[model samples]
Target: PKRKTVEKHGRDLRDIIGQQQGKRALEIAAAGNHNLLFLGPPGTGKTMLASRLCDLLPEMSDEEAMETASVASLTQSEINEHNWKSRPFRSPHHSSSMAALVGGGSVPRPGEISLAHNGLLFLDEMPELDRKVLDSLREPLESGEIIISRAQGKTRFPARFQLVGALNPSPTGYYEGNQARTNPQAILRYLGRLSGPLLDRFD
Candidate 1:
């Protein structure tokens, strides 16, 4: 497919104010393809920071572009020529199912992680997701690909994408401060929804 020239526009890191640590972390993640997690209160620009990480990423190589486009073509009707060479940025909602996050069905279609191949996967409100759904990502995060097996057959999809996650420190979106509404025990349980192994995957 002939690639079209498209003007890329996105949130600039420069426009965000007063998050030196977050900005630095984004730079490091972009440079090394590291998985990242942002923990803070609500309305702290965690999602904003995650969204802009893609802008900092370098252009996809031809091979990478083809790999990413191929996965997208499976789910989308057509790949936009102007964005064919661009890296994918998939942000599945916190309530996504295991199949939705990883990939599954009677026919085994690619999921958000697969579609984000060679690009980025942003998970906002990370701890709010079902534990099972989040843990399903463990293998792919380490192996750079996912294998879907069904009674009829098995299929594999590439999933080598950087993961960026954001979440509040507590259920009420506050923690260990004067305005905190949730108790320490409840807060621990809320954050505990993310298993140790899953949390270990992030830098």
Candidate 2:
């Protein structure tokens, strides 16, 4: 038997997740059409909160659902038959590449970012990814769509997403008091990974 469609009264994710700041950020992502970066230490429940955004959000429009669904199809992800129930949430590893994050391959495919189009791109361990690959995000982050210019012509895919990135403060991931040795140079270098121009684009 087919499942029934039930009316959901938009239970605020904040009520569910309970992180005031993170919930506020999600609200902005839902309202102003902005992307966000959640900077904090590990085990902060960033992932779980990011996931619930789909549930609290208003349902996706049909055109939106289809475009959103197409992006999901590129991946091996067997989208929930109810994929159209809400917006998508795609989380990729830090090892993801420019092509993998942006969308490319021999056969030409949608990458994680593309898959997150009209939804959310939750990037865990933001700094560990190749600087070049991470830099590539600057474009889609601004354009909301990627133009895959190839010899066969150009193919554009929607990439309008709320980018939520999380990264450790340092390689060792810790803070050191006065007596402890903390590398200021390393901190500068790590932060330098996200170039000035790229950083300027994000909210």
Candidate 3:
């Protein structure tokens, strides 16, 4: 089953249209387990390309598969029959809170990053995410783990996965034209959501 899944992913990857540079970057990220940020205007294939990283990634070993499954179980994320060993790919909406991304609640549950253990966490529209929410990922990205503390207790979730972030170049989602919609100051403010320390974590 795992072999078939990997073959199917490879076939899907071959069908992606002309994205030599993006493909190359994905290959490197998959090979080295590095974090990457793709900056461009909307409609650029950033999301599509980021989603294809699973194709190049190797299959999870039994221990990894079990650990990943445990996180999913903790989060109550549905695990289909054939997807138990498949690599996880989590992409939360831009409005997600720090708790949603890093994991927190009255009882504490695995968030997107933890659910993506031994897999990929793709953050599309990176700049649209709140500054604090974005900053919350820095620690996990560095330690390959996340700790959610609640009134009950502290819950630790595995977050060792490659991060693929996609964002526009500016506030207006374009740099070439539409000057009336955005200015240098607006662009600075928009990009400021991604703090310097957080940005430093990406490769």
Please tell me which model should have the higher lDDT, number 2 or number 3. 3
**What does the lDDT read for residue 189 in candidate 1?**
96
lDDT of 2 at 150: 81
Give the distance in Å from residue 166's predicted Cα in candidate 2 to where it truly belongs.
Answer: 1.0
What TM-score, computed on C-alpha atoms, does each candidate reach?
0.93, 0.83, 0.91
lDDT (tens digit, per residue) of candidate 1 on 92-169: 988899889999988899999999899899999998899888889999999999999988878999999999999899
- Candidate 2: tens digits of C-alpha lDDT, residues 92-145: 888877888898876678888888877778887777888888888888888888
lDDT minimum window of 10 residues, candidate 2: 173-182
Q: Which ten residues in a row have the lowest lDDT in candidate 3?
A: 3-12
Would you list the rank order by TM-score, best first? 1, 3, 2
- Model 2 TM: 0.83
Which stretches in model 3 have alpha-carbon errors above 4 Å?
Answer: 1-11
Candidate of highest lDDT: 1
RMSD of 3: 2.6
Q: What is the C-alpha lDDT of each candidate?
A: 0.89, 0.74, 0.85
Residue 94, model 3, lDDT: 95
Score candidate 1 by lDDT: 0.89
Please list the residue runs of candidate 1 whose C-alpha ends up more than 4 Å from where it truly belongs after superposition: 1-8, 176-179
Compared with the true structure, what per-residue lDDT tens digits does model 3 show for residues 99-171?
Answer: 8888888878878999889999999999889888888888888898998887777888889988899999887
lDDT of 1 at 76: 82
